[model samples]
Target: MEKALVYINYPELIPLNDKSTEYDGYITIDDKFTYRIKLQVPNFPDVKNITYSGGRFHYIAIQEEDKLFKLAYYDIPKISSELLKEYASLNELFTTYCNCIEELQTYFDVMDSIDTVCWVIDPPKPKKSDYMRRIMIGHNVSIQITFDPLNILNLPQIQFMGSENGVAPFRESFINNLDNWDPEYDVVQNILRLIDLPFFPQEPTDAAKSNDLDFKVNECCICFCVQLENKLPDEICKNPNCEQCFHTDCLYQWLSAVGTSRQNFNLIQGECPNCKTCISCRIPNI
Candidate 1:
């Protein structure tokens, strides 16, 4: 199964590929407040911001051999899937794999990973602003990555906006192109190491602190108290079995932050934290 994501053009996410600061074929660069917009997304569809998906909310069902992946938000208590007829397309599989997102959220809850709320953005593939790297490392929490702004359109509030203002009023209103996900050379380095991805092998000059495993993690292991440097998580471990922790501020300190990609980000052989013993865990905030 290919571990990938989906990107869609929803009512909230308009086709403002124009006026791009960065040029990539078919990928209109919308970096506008990608930072702030990314943050607001998890909060819900704001009249002032674009809509987004957050939390460890996902559901899956198989019909006629085709797997149907659904997005379920405890926040909205909404269960959604776009007639996901089958689960073969990498896009579908990945999106449906997001069905496991609920499982991921469950995993985080039991394991005490990520403490903060996470905005699950599902994109078909990596984009200029896409940072699976951070979500991979940041501890205890829900994670669903998608670019299908349509997911937001289904949000109760977004639906309201669409009916009242014809949807165009709120399209990408909060996410300016400048906010697109761009990691500096150094920031990428830290994110790669934090995820413990094999994509990049270069270690940090001072790798010891970033690898610290002594602090008392009364909170979620995936949780990072401080705000992310590039809105990417370096603190906490993404894998269930790994006891290692990293820093969010030092994303640029590790190695080449680019090109270190993997199919499955499992580091502990499908075991939970307390690697010494397999402990079934789930996140608390979800």
Candidate 2:
């Protein structure tokens, strides 16, 4: 007898292509296992500014026959099928993937390789799709790539926002455009090395540093401690106009004190204490 494929039990995530109008309220897949890989380019410059560069973040869901997994923060340029076939087990596959990411990291001074978080998102209880969506389990990191040789000043400005507010056709196109999985072809190291980055990143000058301090006052919302440029912030409110930032450790303690346990995507979803704007806390591995 064939083994049963575990379903996510989240209807919203059901692929648009499925024909059934009334979903069983379960995310059934032909494949028993799947992978949701999230790549975040958190530090790209504004497109409206002289530096016209648009970074991409991708969420790839790969269907397999045995397990459900999620990986975060990467930009893969190529993948090879042979090595992937050679390493069929999860442990070997993960090791190979990390090796590729490490190789890619070596090519750029600023790009860093981080540990990929892995966990099984257990199936939700009946009528509890909302509950499942609220819980997240995994490591999160800021995936970055540098354009050291690209002359931002010379490029024409392109008015482009981001996928955070994704519309229909564009979102569909992006999902359809992801390259097919091949472990060997996905070596970004070789691709990035051949192409020169647009601009070499530099440390903030004294004048710029002074201006940043003057404008923001370098203060954290929770502890009132000075937030340096190099320090980690726990939460930054998603509101475009809001500028409130907080230390993760400080905010976590504050949230616990306040008894706000509401969470979404494994993050503490609540309003910023400073600006009253909503924020989601995904505490990094500090």
Candidate 3:
């Protein structure tokens, strides 16, 4: 099969009518057009043969114009499943994977945190270990975190360990440093905090309902996981008739399941899960 072509130069037919309008990157030729220059696939080292269910974590090399740019590892089960379902080849999968990460970068500000994005560890392969994949210098020690796709379900499953270097620092701290670190604690809280999640689950308190009118705000309309003390809702529907609230993550997942359409930043527009009221919903801006 002819690999997807990225026209790096303007075609002869479309002469430089306006030099000022020229762009720096590749110029895509339309389906009716054709070009000769084709990008060659950069050589990537083979991943160690390992067995796992769903999908395997991988350190992928990203290249452009035959130039090696960077390496990254991610829990790509969901993305891989999408690729397999689409019947994409290895090259197509790599390209699509890069494009997906780049697109996600624009959608979530949480991607800004390198500590939250990825964790680096020495793997079984020594020849491939040249530099840290992602890092930050702090307290005279460089703290790093590996980016994991939080789509997994359990705590132990989500805690990604390095092949040879053991676990990253953030996971270590959450386990050893944080006194309240429990399996019950939300796994996505660290990711949420980076995005400045607007509301937290409100804590439910004793005393009668008449004791404090603020008590009603404790329950999430979708999943009534209320607790004692103070917590907050991540987002509330703007619909006047349906003031139903939900955890932003919860709502986002629900929206993806039911929504027929999607907008920028991973937001979905469709009927409300509870009231069946059509609405455009997303994570709060702040």
Candidate 4:
């Protein structure tokens, strides 16, 4: 089948089971969740030969220097027949898992001081020895289920691990689901109520609200003249109290009228752009 083109330039894309450098499709999921996870499979060595498996815990290590996360392994857990029916992959299951955790955290405000984002998955195999494909979640909480390692080893290599990306779609859907979930009024209301953030859900705003959103540096105080032909354009204004620097010639002409514009600075106690509080400044006359 013809594969799609990807424009990502991530240098550490390998060793994460990114399949042959030229390959651009789903990779295998070691026999765990019955192949529910299908995404960019990084190259993992020596995982398929063993069985004694159920659900595996997956790990993704943080690479601070490269700003990329390395593919850690997933610890697949033994899924009951009931769960397999509903979830295609563990990542899909996590959406509900995370949502429930978040809801519980926000509503109760007592997450046992443990970072709540932690849950079970396969752990990285390269860095650790005596690797177990047990389903363990959370860094702080070593919650895990035992597996039959000897039984897993008897499984055929091709059969033990799926060659295709079984869980990729579930990962894609779980991570990017928010792209389609727009924050409509009702969604916002439910989220606010469920998560209990301090956000005041306001209605459609008017033009007056725009003033708060302006990004211009309104409070600048320096004015200087520059040779635009030789460098950049020089501009000046008489509001010496303003932080905006002006061109020398422009400043001289504006102040030349009353001499009140000498190196002298004039300030008016005026209200600020947002809170209407009086702000004063001595504009630098350069």
Model number with the top lDDT: 3
Off by more than 4 A, model 2: 1-197, 212-219, 226-231, 260-265, 283-286
Tell me the tens digit of each residue's lDDT in model 3 across 16-43: 2342221122222333222222222323
Estimated TM-score for each candidate: 0.18, 0.31, 0.25, 0.16
Give the Å shift of residue 259 in candidate 2: 3.3
Best by TM-score: 2
Candidate numbers, best TM-score first, in rank order: 2, 3, 1, 4
Q: What C-alpha lDDT, on a 0 to 100 scale, does residue 29 get in candidate 1?
A: 18
lDDT of 1 at 12: 31
Q: Per-residue lDDT for 1-286 in model 2, tens only? A: 0111112223232322343221112211233322232211222210010110113222222223334322322234333442334323333444444444333332222221111121111121212111111111111111122222122112112111111321233334334533432334322332222222122222245678565432222346677764434343435455546555577777766665656556666567666777665566664454
Q: Which candidate model has the greater TM-score, 3 or 4?
A: 3
lDDT of 4 by residue, 1-286 (tens): 0112122322222332444323222222322222222233233321111111123223322111123222132223222232233333333443433232222322122111111222212232222122232211111112222223223212111111110132233234434543343334233222223322234322123664345332111211223322322222122122324324333333344444432333334532333322333333344344
What tens digits encode model 1's per-residue C-alpha lDDT throughout 1-286? 0111112322232223443211111211133111112111222211112112233222222222223332222221123444333434323433433443332333333222211222221222333223221232222221222322223211111111111122222233322322332333232332223333333222223566366443121222334433332232323433334533333223222312323421133221222232323222221121
Local error of candidate 4 at residue 217 (angstroms): 16
Candidate 4 lDDT for residue 76: 31
For model 3, what is the alpha-carbon lDDT of residue 90? 33
Q: Predicted candidate 2: what Cα RMSD to the true structure?
A: 21.4
